[model samples]
Target: MTEPKAIVSDLESFVAIAKQVIADTRDKKAIPGKLKPYLEQLIRHREWLDERFRQPNPDAFAVYTLHQEPDDSLLIMSAVFLPGQGTPVHDHAVWGLYGVMENQTEDTRYERIDDRSRPDYAELRVVDRRLVRQGEVMISYPPDQDIHRVVNTSDKPTLEIHVYGADLSKLRRRVYDPQTGRVKVIQARVPVN
Candidate 1:
């Protein structure tokens, strides 16, 4: 077996860089596209990220808030998903970049087929299902194309970092039922201190 890669020694510095990137592009129209490079930089330090945030829970997955702006312009978080753990099909309603830090995650992207204006009803169709591996990034934005579910496909814990255009924890987003076309408002779960 080969030796493990070295962990990132300065998570704070990385956070600072991420903050700067977000701050610089907060007013931009294409938030997700503009933040991709910066987010990719973080992915380059995945070994360090995984070392700092990979804590798998037995009952559920763990989400860690690495950084958040005072004005809610940006929120950076790390999430750990254990094998077989996943999220309900949900929408962020904000532009964001999700980068894999460790192992692999299977993301099933969807498209709403009916009028999303009706909160209680929604029709969705699967657009794509792909495995996002370590060092890879996924972009979400425009609300319409952001509905999806993420699942951990590996036996080991999977770690991922997300950079959002707003404080996702404070947003009341929508979770959809693909089978029944039902929709419900759900608050995004933020990490505890």
Candidate 2:
């Protein structure tokens, strides 16, 4: 239905809970049975978070931290995409999950192929493409697993709830050359006064 009021307070709290769940699983070498329900609840919460993104306002791109420790981190990201707003092909190094709140989005996955040249780079070839709709959850892994791009394919707008395993704002995310697959880490720009 709708996102609960409590989940919107801050992103750090959501990250904390997610990190705790991840830690509990790693420390015990397996996910504890008790955490199963919590995981499902988080998934449901993610769905609700996405609902808040169904508008075309950039002001709606509210991101909150769920966790930010050295070992593990989590973030609850809400994004409202206007028509034609899309991301360049890139990779999220850590694991992540996203729930679509409204409308639909298109995701295209690529395969990295090595190319030796003056500048060593990887070539990307589209291997899979999918159209995801409302209430759908997409999960991804790191490295060679899930290099892809996301786009809102609707005339109106779309909303999505994203759960990241790391602090993406602080991390150096890579953007790949769609044709050459050359990898370059994107740095944040500091605005001058």
Candidate 3:
């Protein structure tokens, strides 16, 4: 059995390491060849984050702030989703990884298509849908690929660990309405502090 303190500590450690890697990658303007193997390894650790997210939470969503660097370049956060609680279709412009710390999360991906000329709003095509069970993870690279929505699909609340390569505070992310096909800018707030 893992203690809550230990799980939180581990997340903090990994966030620190990943932050350095992100900085190095930025400086090199490329992902270093030597880091490829470990990058994959880090992806594996993302699943480990699910354990901490499994801890109890009273609210529909709870965030545990593991790290908030001085420059706000990185943020390691955890969220708990009560049954049926979730965000609308949205996208993050920075790189991020999410792991199911407890239970399963159903997610759907969408592709954006602009129809600015018609004033009819943008079109979003469903790309994929899947249930991310415990120990499963997903990674998002911004700009090109980042639009999706996640929901808790089980009787019990779900937990998730989210690591962002950049601080997401007040960032304008796109939100889409599948039913209406409307696209709008929405601010992603750090609810956990």
Q: Return whichever of 1 and 2 wins on lDDT.
A: 1
lDDT per residue as tens, model 3, 1-193: 1111222235555555565667657533232332333333443454455556455555556677667777777677778888877778887767777777568899888887764464336677888999988766677766546788888878998877676656675586677787887667766644211
RMSD of 3: 6.7
Q: How high is the CA lDDT of each candidate model?
A: 0.75, 0.58, 0.65
| Error in Å for residue 17 of model 2 | 5.6
Residue-by-residue lDDT tens digits, candidate 2, 57-175: 56322333333466545555566667766677877766767767667789889877664363436677898999887767676666656678887777867666666666665666677
- In model 1, what lDDT does residue 169 have? 68
Worst 10 residues of 2 by lDDT: 27-36
Q: Which residue runs does candidate 2 get wrong by more than 4 Å? A: 1-17, 27-72, 115-120, 188-193
Q: How would the candidate models be sorted by lDDT, starting from the highest?
A: 1, 3, 2
lDDT for predicted candidate 1 compared with the true structure: 0.75
Give the TM-scores of the predictions, in the order they appear.
Answer: 0.83, 0.68, 0.74
Q: TM-score of the candidate numbered 2?
A: 0.68
Model 1: CA > 4 A from native = 1-29, 46-52, 190-193
lDDT of 1 by residue, 79-142 (tens): 8899998888888877877888778999999998886588799988999999998888898886
Model 3 TM-score relative to the real fold: 0.74
